[model samples]
Target: MRKRIIIFDDDKDTRTICSLILEGLNFEVITQENCIDILRILDLHTPHVILIDNHLPGMKGAAGIRLVKESPRHKHIPVVFFTGTNNAQALADEAGADFVLPKPVDLARLEEVIELAINS
Candidate 1:
């Protein structure tokens, strides 16, 4: 079965690029520009993994990660922080992410990370 992947990013290009890359790898991608009511996305289904922008417009980098990590219903899904910053991986670690990938994410690396997360 294809893994469900939920992506949260404010940039159209980033979101679209990620959707395309993941789709090519056979992941079912569910993307959103707004994180206001992520509960709605949860209703659609629990993604096997989540890809969140390190710097969202309204929310702080780690704040959004905390909310998802703390949520009882959605907590189990592994999250990877994606950012253009040089410190992206550090931020992800601080935010308690399972992994972190530099933005303009390499599709090959992402596929490996996702597979590892799923297998683990």
Candidate 2:
């Protein structure tokens, strides 16, 4: 079965591009504009990996990551912090993400990180 990845990003372009790229890589991609119902989403999708943006409409990525991390059922899923901040790494570390991807995204790096997160 193809591995599934969930991307929570507010930007339409980013989500579209990422969905396309990941789909091309033989991944099943699911995109959402916000993580308002993160745990519910996780339960529904059961993604292999999660890519979340820092600035979201309702719940921030860090908070959502925390929820996932705290959940025994979902804690094992690797999370990639996707941000455009200068302190991306620090923010990701604080958020307990397994990896970080900055925007505007570097395609090769995005692919590499996703692979690592999936394998991890």
Candidate 3:
């Protein structure tokens, strides 16, 4: 079965581009504009990984990542924080994210991170 990935980003272009890239890599991708429905989505579809933008509409991506890591059902799933900030890696680490990827995402790096998340 193809690995599934859930992505949360407010930018339509980012979401679309990431989804397309992930799909091309044989990953089933689900895109969300915010973190509001994360629990619902997780309950329905257990994605292998989650990619969240640091700045979101409702909650900060770091907080969202914390929530996911706190949840018993979803805690095991790896999370990657995507941001344009210089401290993206530190923010992700503070939030308990498994990985971090800079915005204007490099497709090759994205693939490497996803593979590492899945394998580890």
Candidate 4:
């Protein structure tokens, strides 16, 4: 089966670009604008990796990552905190994210992070 990646970011362009890139790399990519129903989404997709941006419309990405980490059923899945925010590494650490991806996202780095998350 193809590896699945779930992305939560409010920016439409980022989501589209990421989807295209990952899809090209043969991943099944799912993107959401917010993490309001993150658990529901997780239950449905069971992704290999989750990429999230800190700023979101509701249920911010950091909080969403925390929620997933706190869940016994889903905590094993790797989470990559993708953000443009300052102190992103600190925020990702606080939220228990497995990795961090900073924006103006370098597509190559994005792919590298995803690969690391999947392989780790």
How accurate locally, in lDDT, is each candidate? Answer: 0.80, 0.94, 0.91, 0.95
Top-scoring candidate (lDDT): 4
lDDT of 2 by residue, 65-117 (tens): 98899999999999999899899898888878999888889999999999999
Residue lDDT tens for model 4, 17-113: 9999999999999999999999999999999999999999977899999999999989999999999899999999999999999999999999999
Tell me how candidate 3 scores on lDDT. Answer: 0.91
Q: Which stretches of candidate 3 lie over 4 Å from their true place?
A: none
- Model 1, range 10-30, lDDT digits (tens) per residue? 889888888998899889999
Predicted structure 4: lDDT: 0.95
Give the higher-TM-score candidate: 1 or 3.
3
TM-score against truth, every candidate: 0.86, 0.97, 0.95, 0.98
Q: After superposition, how far is residue 43 of candidate 4 from its true place, in Å?
A: 0.2
**Candidate 1 RMSD to the correct structure:** 1.8
User: Cα RMSDs of all predictions?
Assistant: 1.8, 0.7, 1.0, 0.5
Candidate that beats the other on TM-score, 1 or 2, i.e. the better one? 2
Candidate 4 Cα errors over 4 Å, as ranges: none
Which lDDT tens digits does candidate 3 get at residues 1-120? 999999999999999988999999999999999997788888888899999998899888999999999999899999989899889988888899998899889989998988999887
- With a 3 Å backbone cut-off (N, CA, C), the pairs that clash in candidate 1 are none
| Descending-TM-score candidate ranking | 4, 2, 3, 1
TM-score of 4: 0.98
